[model samples]
Target: MALSFDGYKLTEIINPNGHCTQIGFTNENEPDVKKRGVILFDRQIRYIEVEEHQKFKRVKVYTTKDAEPMDFDFLEDNYANFDLFLRSIYNQ
Candidate 1:
């Protein structure tokens, strides 16, 4: 499966510091949030990436619309790889 945000395909993860929040909002009446980009991973692997620089567990996943306002803080808190993250999510 593939996920795209604001015309930007979920290709690589962004720096989780002050960069993830760089995504701005639209000028619509309600000011909708616009995403800067997206982080690509497998539904079964749940690895987060920023150019193969790092890998981590998904820990938690949520619909972008209902997720915390531009919060990717979890990206900085977890790092389970080698199929571990994926395995944890499925309990398989």
Candidate 2:
């Protein structure tokens, strides 16, 4: 995949793991970076993918209220639950 921020373009490929997934970002023909994270729920299950970069960031991709599989639980009540979830996954 190609990721562009501002003007710099970053390309990556999807290297799926058994459970989680990995992204190989390439720049200037060299391995620019490696982003390892978990795909907790795909669009099929929850209509969103939550990825955390181990204390760096917790982001929800392709997220929309209508696309949500069910009513938002953790976000509606305990926002901390999401943080805890990320921590647990990263620790494992």
Candidate 3:
């Protein structure tokens, strides 16, 4: 699905397991770049970008609420929990 708000256009992609990933882009006609992030839930999102860390390539997950590093496995669990949460809400 697609939504527009606050000068940004957002699109959500739901996998077969019901995990959601969102991509956002500016409302401008010619945007120089588009941004992507993982939306765990309401108000719980992480914006990430590719970076080089310790001579190795990685995607850094940035958050204002915590200083802990979010690795791939942790993010995987978040996605699984989100999928389960959606199922619980819909099954009810």
Best by lDDT: 3
In order, what lDDT does every prediction score?
0.31, 0.34, 0.39
- Badly placed stretches (over 4 Å) of model 3 are 1-39, 53-56, 73-92
Give the top-scoring candidate (TM-score).
3
As a whole number from 0 to 100, the lDDT of residue 76 in candidate 1 is 32
The TM-score ranking, best first, is: 3, 2, 1
User: TM-scores, in order shown?
Assistant: 0.20, 0.23, 0.25
Clashes of 3: 0
The sequence of per-residue lDDT tens digits that candidate 2 reaches over residues 6-32 is 222223323343344332222343345
Q: Give the per-residue lDDT of model 3 (tens digit) for 1-92.
A: 22223333333334333334343334465466465434543333345545544433333444556554433221332454434433432332
What is the C-alpha RMSD, rounded to one decimal, of candidate 1? 12.9
lDDT of 2: 0.34
Query: Against the true structure, candidate 3 has what lDDT?
Result: 0.39
Give the TM-score (vs. native) of candidate 3: 0.25
Clashing pairs in 2: 1-12
Decreasing lDDT order of the candidates: 3, 2, 1
Candidate 2 regions with alpha-carbon error over 4 angstroms: 1-48, 51-73
- What residue pairs clash in candidate 1, if any at all? none
